[model samples]
Target: MGIKKEIEIRCHPLMSWDISNPILSLKSRTKEDLKLLSELSKQNNWEVDFAKELAMSYQTLVLTDLQQTILWVNAGFQTMTGYTADYALGKKPTFLQGEKTSEKVKSRIREKLSKGRRVSETITNYKKNGLAYDCLITIIPLLDSNQVITHYLALEREAA
Candidate 1:
């Protein structure tokens, strides 16, 4: 792997902080930013555009169909996983998994997905170059108006 890829995989932000006071970092929020955040807080999964915009931020976010096929991924995902959208789209997220990825974790994730429940777990995942790293992945089931699962939205951040 190149220096850029190694740096990308290792330099991701870790979720080991005490950020209970998130409002402390809102010192420069524009009116529009506040409005967007308010709107997102009220939205579930029906708002695709809003979700896409939210995913475009620093945290890695990915969307997959109910069948687990990748639909879209944010730029942050590309930076962190070393898989560009062109190569990642239309593939399953498991393409990033390797021998180090625990089968127990995969089974747990599948069980939660089958039950249409949100899953939060720290698991080993590989980058495009096959280098493994720990990620705290939160997968939220997206439901249609009739309460049927339509998709899944995954937010991933580095874990120790």
Candidate 2:
């Protein structure tokens, strides 16, 4: 399949953005306009109810760094682990990896991540209360413009 094509749009004031004058090229915009574009891309429809869609099911986590910091966690994390996002953030993700966690498994992950390769596996994790559960994991490295690895992106689901 071919790659998707992105449509380019020039956002401007209603007065200057005349549909009838399609042939006219718009003047360059200021840095402020670029910032506006960036903000628009990141905006979400806060009016939409996400909890309703989730129906109080499912868990999600965003893991990062070698320390495995819990950069972000959703409501599901609270439902599953009984820990709030406030408590999870800035802490090592391995807090969930308990005594039974295999050092071999952790080392395998370390090797792959150090080379900036993606890895998928099913491993054991613990809840705040010390209850253990299996989790299917996907780890992705977020790279900067220079292609250097920065943060790790981890998607986790209950192991079936």
Candidate 3:
């Protein structure tokens, strides 16, 4: 089989992405993006050849720097949280926390972060409308080639 045939056989329907007009170009992507792309490609059977676009297409993806400053948020995040990327950028994830949010959960998350560990917590998060809802947040650490933590990929979903 040829290279084209190999790709055709390996590519899953969900992995199909238009490379013609990618959201973020491969050349312009940051080191973190490259690292994430490589990681995602290796872990999943799906062809993540267009990892940049796949990341953008994620329903609840929120990329943040090591300092926890928002770097990029996907459209799904905007629709779910009611905050545009422009408004969310450079802000901490704590911005979503409100009076109804759990203090114990916040402290646990902080502690886990200080230890540079992945955290999965279900807590109350308020939307822009001030309506509180339970959200399952999973923060994954993005590491560089040398294993230095560079960024975080926070996946959020409404808890049933």
Candidate 4:
């Protein structure tokens, strides 16, 4: 006589199955990201799910008010900039700039943002530790149902 046994492992949709691995399954990650998007959408009154795909593509996802004050930042922002969300909140993105940053590029970015146009630029940004890194930034204006710009979303990745 022979007996056969099988074991099945089930994991919570919000958690990683591999306890030693920090990275989550794609499905779990998506669920978590959607939850965050839902909260942001509810709080800001904007449909932000459109950015779900972009949330993981960039190293940092920064949300700022129309006045350019930081509202939120994803975990990658802390990994890349050495600054926590608590420290970055309420601060202008310019706080990441340093003496080595380009004035011309800053002027161009300001002009584009003021015109409600999207801006994509590679610029120098300083980390909390005072180290400079080249970052590629893409800023898009977030609009409400009425098409009124209420916030800005910046996707940033460290330039190779």
Q: TM-score winner among the candidates?
A: 4
Error (Å) of candidate 3 at residue 4 is 34
Question: Backbone collision count in every prediction?
Answer: 0, 1, 0, 0
On lDDT, who's better, 2 or 4? 4
| C-alpha lDDT of candidate 4 relative to the true structure | 0.71
User: After aligning candidate 2 to the native by TM-score, how far in Å is the CA of 103 from where it should be?
Assistant: 1.2
Ten contiguous residues minimizing lDDT sum, candidate 3: 7-16
How does candidate 1 score on lDDT? 0.64
In candidate 4, what are the lDDT values of residues 1-160, reduced to their tens digit? Answer: 1000100011122223533354554344445445665655665577446545465456777778788888767656777898876778779999999999999999999999899888999999999999999999999888777778888888899998
Write candidate 3's Cα lDDT for 1-160 as tens digits: 4322332232222112424533553233333344544544354322323454435323466777778887666445655777766777779988999988989999998899778788988989888888888988877776655566767777777776
Number of residue pairs clashing in candidate 4, backbone atoms closer than 3 angstroms, sequence gap of 3 or more or interchain: 0
Q: Write the candidate numbers in order of decreasing TM-score.
A: 4, 1, 3, 2
**Model 1, stretches more than 4 Å misplaced?**
1-58
Best by lDDT: 4
lDDT of 1 by residue, 1-160 (tens): 5322322343223222313433332222223233433343344335344434444323466667777887666545766798886687778999988889999999999998899888988889898888899988888786655677777878787775
- Report how far residue 119 has shifted in candidate 3, in Å: 0.8
How does each model score on lDDT?
A: 0.64, 0.54, 0.63, 0.71
Q: Model 2: runs farther than 4 Å from truth?
A: 1-58
Checking candidate 3 for backbone clashes, the offending pairs are: none
